[model samples]
Target: MKLNLILFFFCTLVTISWAQSPNLSKYNEEIKKIEDTVKYFEVEKINDQFYMLIGGGGNVGVFVSDKNVIMVDNKYEIIEEVLMSSLREITSNPIKYIINTHYHHDHSDGNRAFGKMGVPIISHENAKVRMQKVTQLYGGIYDFIDGFVQDKYPTEALPIITYNSKLTLSEDGEDIEMYNFGSGHTDGDSIIYFKNANIMHTGDAFVRYGYPYVDLNNGGSIKGIIEVLGSIASLANDQTVIMPGHGNLSTKQDVLDLKKSLMNLYQKTVLGLEKGLSYQEIADSIDETLAADPVMPGAELTKLNYIKSIELELNN
Candidate 1:
């Protein structure tokens, strides 16, 4: 019996140690290999000073000024080094600021790496709060299925500067406006506008990713996103260039089109719910309507989640 207890104790200690720190060397090496690939990230020149870095995560807005470079969003930390290397090809200016559109990992995961370098990270107050805690994404739809868990950001990863509604920064004779019209993709979504450049980064609040994913679990709603989209459209003109959270660069008309599509889905959800239809039934109806629309893969599941979010909002 004593020998068995000793063996059990040894196994327990090993298990504890492994749990505390798992071996990730192989994982790290594999990820490095992928990151080192040249086509892992793509950069599109917006103009002389502004550019958009696509892939490796959410779209990164690179605004180069004479003094420093301001990034609208930094993708995952795993790609931080490679991302910086790509930026070096554009400008040698040091990164001055990183404005997080929201607290989602894809959009703000590099906060720790940049913040440690003394870069001032800016985000909406609510986003800062959300980042400080573990965020369970996709509402609870995947609670028993395949759920996405966003770990809590460390103090260094949290935004150093936070704004309530609107904050304007004057840099290189241009006004960079950050506005939080309300909760959309997340409670802290920021719509960034470069006044002089005539360019806008609509973060996740406005994405080209077929159907937008609302973080209903993190204070996001279909109605809120719809409203924010309209506000962003009003702020743009024919000359404005839109850099969405994901997908290719867009225009004001595209924003309006997205808004209309979401509005259509929102109305359909409401109507289905009023008629006592099940969530799946509503989603099916939505899916049929969106059959002609361009959507990302796995849109069927996305539509179900979208319908659930709208139903949640109406019920509340």
Candidate 2:
């Protein structure tokens, strides 16, 4: 009886271990694949909207006026100083409103930096809850407080002003409208549309390069991203300039193209699953049918991940 019990315990432990070991081979390959994609630290003027791109895929927005400025998103904590310097060169106005598009590190990590400057951060109500958890757990708040001697973005830094769907900010003479596109990139994904400039900043939900990352864990969805992009596409025109969360500034056509690619990939995978292909089989096989179009943006989510995302969209 004792020997049988011991054997059963060992087998159960092995099974549990096997279940927990995630294969990171695809992740490593993704990092390698996007390594050559140059990360820009420069600020560029996209139409009337002045924008900056940080390493990774965070798109930082600067709506400048003689009185003050409203920054849509800050890239990373490290890049805050540089981004600030760039903003200062263009406008001497103090940064008043910083709207975070989501809770992703690349986009919202700079929340603390701006908060340090006494700037008020604005975001979806949910983003604050998510960032607060991250700051407490992985961000080492105790160490940060003692060593850095700096408040690593206290709770106040987290969107003192929260909203449900839409919020508008008027700084200087510019009118910027922030809209929550319902679980596109993340649960808190925001798109800042500059009403005066006819430029829209699609935060991460509108990357021009590779596949979009629907962080399903954080309320992201392939279908949601597609829906958001489609809405933006409808609002855009040839004259409308798009500032994506990553990649070069785009036109209305760029949004249309990205939407088409994503929808096509999604439909293809739905059909594949109808034929009873498993998720793995569908993900690994999507590229076979996609055939050398514009690749997806994120390294974390690769071409194969596109197939998996489609599979998820179908299952949901």
Candidate 3:
């Protein structure tokens, strides 16, 4: 009986270890290969409000106010303690609200963590649906969708509040306007604007480096991203700071340059579409005339991926 009990205990430990390996591994690749040597949560001051960039599956925005703390996206469950503790380095105020840019795992996995703190979590109605699927597939512990699915099963981290079109939030004297950026990065991608701070947090909807990934399968569109970015150009200006889905913090001119690149790609693809070119023909053949503009280093892969996504979009 004693031997059986010991074996059971050992097995339980192994199971727990195996279950946790995935969550930790999620950031392993990101942390291991950062060429910029940029640690997560590089702190910066914008209009007196401190903003921290928490880069994981995507980048998260930590907006510190005088009275309350507002978070854009939760990093991951494994890092919830770390992310929160890091926040403590800046302010001890409890996280008042968290907005899910979309339903992707890297952004929403921390929902359970913040939920435990009793903070109200909100997202687009579509974002909630996507997260439910990620939760079921990963068993609620990890974010990788394939190959690790068997090892990283996790529970669904659902959102408490969901908005369809737009939601305006006023908390502790800060004005945050969450606007759906159409079907750019995702069907429910939202642009979180801090009115007082003159900061706009563009989720995966606006990644700074590489060719942007438009998850067309999940209602993303390359053309849509271009249109959305065009609109955001008006929403921002020379003094406005832009928080992207990934990469470093940037400015309105930086965001504008990004839009121009996508627009160039779209115009190329549209011309190909007019010619009735097949997806492969355009993806492999369309000229990247705008590739040199944004000039994000190590984004050669992204350019190809952008071309391929455009081709796929035309086919669809």
Candidate 4:
């Protein structure tokens, strides 16, 4: 009995240690698939000076020049080295700047990797604050998930440079402007524009995915998204090439159409609420209010998920 007890205690200790460290073979095996996906990245050249790196976590914008390169939204840390390898295929210039559009992990997770290499990161001041301080995320759908919320970012990962409204960067004969139009996807959302290229990177504020996710827990709202979309759309034209946070390259008309759809969704949702319909009921009734083109492949639940999110925020 004594020997059995000792063996049990030893097993318990080993289990506890494994759980705490989480770097054993089992854990590594589970993450190997993710690493495999990150090992291979895809690049789409927007023009001679600009390229798009996809497959990290968010779509990365690459602006290459004779002198150096600038990146927008450096996906997750897992894909850092692979992303750089892909970038080298296009330009030999070093990455001098990394502009984070928001504080979301998928968009800015790699900031630390780039920062460590002396690449200066720029973002809206609110984004920097959200990274340094803890913000309570409120929502029922996400409350059940453990480890889904972040309290704070590491000191090295925080944005080194922050701006209030707008900041302009002129390098390699390119004029890049970063603008903050209040809160849309987050309190510190930034819409970056390459002035000469007529290309805009609309972070999570504008995604190709159906029904944008508003982080109400992070100062995001459907109403705010509507307003922000209008502001960004005004800056586009027939010649504009929109590089959204996710999805394919878009034109100015696509942004406008999305704005109209969101407007319809807002009006329809309010009407459903007035009628005392349940959240799911309201979501079911608003199918016609969403955008129809470029249907989100394999994302059947995206609209419903977004509607549920809106329902949760509206009632709260």
Q: What TM-score fits each model? A: 0.84, 0.74, 0.75, 0.82
Worst 10 residues of 3 by lDDT: 135-144
Where in model 2 is the C-alpha error above 4 Å?
1-40, 47-49, 53-57, 135-153, 278-301
Please provide the root mean square deviation of candidate 1 (C-alpha atoms, Å).
4.4
RMSD, every candidate, angstroms: 4.4, 9.6, 7.0, 5.5
**What's model 1's TM-score?**
0.84
Q: Candidate 2: global Cα-lDDT?
A: 0.68
For model 3, the local distance difference test gives: 0.69
lDDT of 4 at 309: 67
Model 4, span 178-292: residue lDDT tens:
9999878888999999999899999989987676767788788778899999999998888999999988888888888888888887777788878988766776787663442
Residue lDDT tens for model 1, 1-316: 9999999999999999877653435334534654675355687997899999987668999999998999999987777887888899899999888999999877887887888778899999999999887666764322222255676788888888899999999889889999999978888999999998899999999887677778887888779999999999999998899999988899999999889988888888888889999988877776453321242446666677667767667777
Best by lDDT: 1
lDDT of 3 by residue, 1-95 (tens): 99999999999999998776544453445434442343445555554565755544567788877778889887666666567666777788777
Q: Lowest summed-lDDT stretch of 10 residues in model 1?
A: 139-148
Q: Candidate 2 on 253-279: residue-level lDDT in tens?
A: 888888887887677778778988876
Evaluation by lDDT, superior candidate among 1 and 4:
1
Taking all chains together, the TM-score of candidate 3 against the true structure is: 0.75
Error of 3 at 307 (Å): 2.5
Winner by lDDT between candidate 4 and candidate 3: 4
After superposition, which runs of candidate 3 have C-alpha atoms over 4 Å from their true positions?
Answer: 1-40, 134-156, 273-301
